[model samples]
Target: MSPTPEPGLPARVRVHEVGPRDGLQNEKALLPFDVKAEFIHRLAAAGLTTIEATSFVHPKWVPQLADAERLFPLLRDLDGVRLPVLVPNERGLDRALALGAREVAVFASVTESFARANLNRTVDESLAMFTPVIARALDAEVPVRGYLSMCFGDPWEGEVPVDRVVRVARRLIDLGCAELSLGDTIGVATPGQVTALLTALNGAGIPTERLAVHFHDTYGQALANTLTALRHGVTTVDASAGGLGGCPFAKSATGNLATEDLLWMLEGLGIETGVDLDRLTGTSLWLAAHLGRPSPSRTVSALSPKES
Candidate 1:
């Protein structure tokens, strides 16, 4: 067996906050549009430059974010913030464009099962679906993000092939996506898997600078996987405040890597993220109170007083 090759880590990382879109999507109790808007504002004020605001999917698909149009307008005046919304298709893109979204994201799955379950299409079909969406966004001078879910493991297929992930990722980049976010949807990835995946992607000519990692903490490896990504030169990571949301299609998928938890590790390593840990923790606490549940973030739990 060969030891994993360590790449030089970046001096700073960009944490993409996905709480408003991805996090709230899986919640049963749909928050009001004002609540969601306030949440995004709080996240931005806490120094999250890249916050995924809302998804332009049909209301039938994700009722929690059905107020996307209304919600986006409320945060239009937020300064120095990049609010990217998820667009599932051309119609979704149309909705986002109507809302004057400057950035948007499209999602696909690396595995066939997840692709079908999540997108109701095959892998190739899903990519083809996003082709026009990506093109139109780029034509409109809007930056588009590509989300490749089930990169490491799939709920039905178990461990996914690294080659498949790389192939899908390359296609995404070729389709005009400005950046790609690799997701550990079920959180079954270990550090070794993370390194191997990134190495394979790098070998396929996908630079780390154009990639982001999205990890779920189901198997308690989100932080470790993130560390491995950092060491492999990936500077962008996807996290949710309060560790909210899971995959509705993937039954085993759990909460995403918490922003507070990721921030703690980065700050401890003296890595800059321009995010305030205390303020982030408070934001999580406020969100937890709204959700009427304790945060799943270990850092938030550890930092809060008994009374809190």
Candidate 2:
């Protein structure tokens, strides 16, 4: 594949849309299954090839996505899209497998505080637990994506070390994850920090091709960090439609890098993401109305035509 228009970027970037699952998970109002299904359908129709549909986590933990079992069945008609769901443990993986999930994602944090708060396990313990889960997914022929949260900074621990992040990431990749998504959970990462982290990962021999970046727009640095990652040759990026979803564990964490926002930049840079920005913006606008608030995405706010 050719490099992107930017001197060192990839020719085409693959955007992994996490809106339906991630976006709605953080909402105060619980949407009906039909509404969630429609949103997923609209997102896929807007040219997102990989849309994370839902998570198989226990309802007690995240009441919003308790409908995962019911939701996946309704998404069968979305034929060509890859709908990966988050599976936090063996039970979650089992639930996903029973529902015929072809791709699943597992999440862990680099900081011990985050690991304990989020999963009730230490960083090492969480990694140990995922080993079996990842093995099971691989045995079942399902591609597993490992999500390393708190890659740049942690709310409880402050600035996270790059080596700590790299160690956890290496462990995940070694444990059979097909790809690793480094997440700035608190949205506190700057472009310089992003560069240093990627550089360290590269030095550790993990090619950018096996990685994706997940950034929060909390400090309004998501796009800048994404641009740095793209320059480093990382092609896959995780974004939520309509700027939905925030870290429940991190109080200061606001929202993800919006799909519309990322699309606007990609479109301007002449990068082929196969996404229709106009259609995506329309989706966000519709979702905003349903959520009873304006979208946080600058691109969506700027591009959406006003009602007469």
lDDT of each: 0.91, 0.91
**In candidate 1, what residue range of length 10 has the lowest lDDT sum?**
1-10
Alpha-carbon runs more than 4 Å astray in model 2: 1-5
lDDT, candidate 2, equals 0.91
What TM-score does each of the candidates earn?
0.96, 0.97
Residue 109, candidate 2: C-alpha displacement in angstroms: 0.6
Candidate 1: tens digits of C-alpha lDDT, residues 1-308: 12233446677899999999999999988888998888888898899999999999999988998999889999988988999999999999999999899999999999999988889999999999999999999999999999999998887888999999999999999998889999999999999999998898889988888999999999899999999889888999999998999987888989999999998888777788999888888888988888888999999999887863
What is the TM-score of candidate 1?
A: 0.96
| Displacement of the residue 35 alpha carbon in candidate 2, Å | 0.4
Model 2 residue 57 CA deviation in Å = 0.9
